[model samples]
Target: MVVDDSPFSRTLLADSLQQEGCEVVGEADSIECLIETYRQCKPDIVTMDIAMPGADGFECSRALLAHDPKAKIILVSSMKDEETEAEARRCGVVGYLQKPVEGEVLKKVIEGVMSPDVLYNNLQSWSIDIFKEALGQSITRMTKTTATFVEAECSEKNISQGITVVIGIIGHYPGSMILDISKESAEKMAEVILRRPAKGQDEVVAMGAEFANVVGGIACSMLNKKDKAFSLRVSPPSVFYGAQTEIASPGIRLHCLYADSDFGRIYLGVGFKKGSVLWM
Candidate 1:
């Protein structure tokens, strides 16, 4: 909930909080209806302004605290007086912010007050980052060559022919990591990792699958370690070859990226049915 005498300021504050993933339950311009509104909404946190019609923020905060001692309130105002801030603290305001607040700062303050939602958001945002870091390191270590990673459009049309390695993920959310590369690229990777010429198509399949496995395993391990809620496990890689093989999953969202290696380009996609759909 947000309480400010100015409707414009209140709306601006509410919009900023919403952008940071905070759900504003209610808004108020006066203290007359604040108590009843608070009781009705039971919001997680309340942001209060110093200048209101009837009573100032401090008085309203004190009154609310008197009613419910556990009420979480944050004083947000242009007024910056040490004595006033001290009085707010004395009344039970958990945080104090000046007139303008940055998005990240607002998020941090809210995170200090309530952490579960922020933690979940952090996990979902980090999902794409896991794969981003994993693939760069996996190829660099295995092939002893640096790769250029860049954001790419993610869609079913991007799925191409040649060597494709599919690795299923189970835990946290059921999804899969798909790796696509040309046969020549697979052979080059296999030969480089093997330190010799890849014998045949069998060697290409084995090496391609192993490469995908390394990426999926490292990425999932990072994700699982991020939080207890994400107990992600990477499945064995399934190798497919040629354009005749078709892959389809109707109800999953995909995030795609490509890395350019010394030998060839490698495309990686992570698909899941749930969690943060838009990657930041």
Candidate 2:
């Protein structure tokens, strides 16, 4: 279930959820209709937007919990503050995702809340340490600057007006690897890689793709080395730019790795289809 005043946001979020193998049973733009929508849809989870007509997300969340004590609600809002998060928790919200939520992050949060034990075991099995090491090494090798692992979060978000490089993974565990960075960050990284200032958007985008390719290649190699049966092939990187670009893959469970450098924050993501042998 998705609730938002903006039709565009609703559609975008719904599409992302659907791509994550979630069935969007219902949508509501106002709190007045939220109860009815929830009752009719009988959704297991709800993504509630903060701002809306009549009542805000906090109140609606409380109402939903009142209606159904088992309701699992995650508050989505553009505002990020301690007070908001505390209040959301007070209202019985299970989770909170700041807008614009990234699809990978959102899916993880949902799964974590739904089945914490399973999510925790899956994360452990995924060998997050290997991916983190690969990311750190790749960034240092490409940029000649040490990259530090900051923090990683999962959410459904809109990457507004940025450069995104996507590389598809094909083999025993087919999936995709994506790198999303701001234009300014791309330009800075491109300059570092080229040993000169990036001239235009084309150069920046190309450099971004190169960065993603190197990182993806390294990660895949490391995974395959750890498990001989996990042979993986990476497709050529694809780049895209737009005002508000969202990416998601249906039936895939996504994980994001965050690294910080002189340029800016880098979001490295790996996604594999649910029920893959890799997870089992």
Candidate 3:
């Protein structure tokens, strides 16, 4: 929501937010209209103009905040002085933006005011995207056939396969990816890639490790590019073999996904634990 007396400023702010893919839920010209509009729309962020007709931005902010203590409000004005900014801070304003604020600047301030859980959820989404796309594209590049997620086990997320490769993710978000593909399937994929018969279980194990390495490296590279804070690095692949093998990761967010291709189904168990000492 935007509360500004000037139609041009309101339109500009709304347009900038819309370009950022945010919906403009409500707009108010002054404090008189802000409360009703807020109650009706219940927007996530309210950008309040400091200079208005009657009450000014400070009183308006206080009024709205009194109504909703949890309201995330941003004060915008031509006043860039420290005193004005301090006053805004004292008024419970979560963010302050000077007039002629750039669209990206406004977006960053809005993101800054967002709750930690919301921000973490966004990071989780981006991380999951990197993992899913890396696995699918890597397999497709290797086998020349499209791979996609199929029906996957939700309970236990177990791997009832002959071989499992563990890849460690280190740095900001430490995690592990357990990749499992049966020995026969691994051999078939090796045959497809090498255009020859796979040597045996030895070669299959090596190939499986290499496959996990490639996928893990891709995920880490993408994350490192996403944000330097992620500071992610892929650890050397570890290989294990058994029937009904599973690994436990305490204090981590976990998700299991399975993808299928002409070769076979790939069972992936991915988990990440936060609170690592950031590398940079």
What local distance difference test score does each model get? 0.79, 0.76, 0.79
Off by over 4 Å in 2: 1-124, 274-280
The estimated TM-scores of all candidates read: 0.55, 0.52, 0.56
A best-first ranking of the candidates according to their lDDT comes to: 1, 3, 2
Judged by TM-score, which candidate is best? 3
lDDT of 2: 0.76
**Runs with alpha carbons beyond 4 Å of true place in candidate 1:** 1-121, 245-247, 275-280
Write down the RMSD of all candidates, one decimal each: 14.2, 15.6, 10.8
Q: What lDDT tens digits, residue by residue, belong to model 2 across residues 62-149?
A: 8889999998888777876878766875787777777887776687677766875564354346635666787788778888898787
Q: In lDDT terms, which candidate is top? A: 1
Whole-model lDDT, model 1? 0.79
TM-score for candidate 1 = 0.55
Candidate 1 residue 149 C-alpha distance from true site, Å: 1.1
Count of clashes, each model: 0, 12, 0
lDDT of 3 by residue, 105-183 (tens): 6775575466444534555777766887889988988888888785454454454677888898885457888788988
Work out how many backbone clashes candidate 2 has.
12
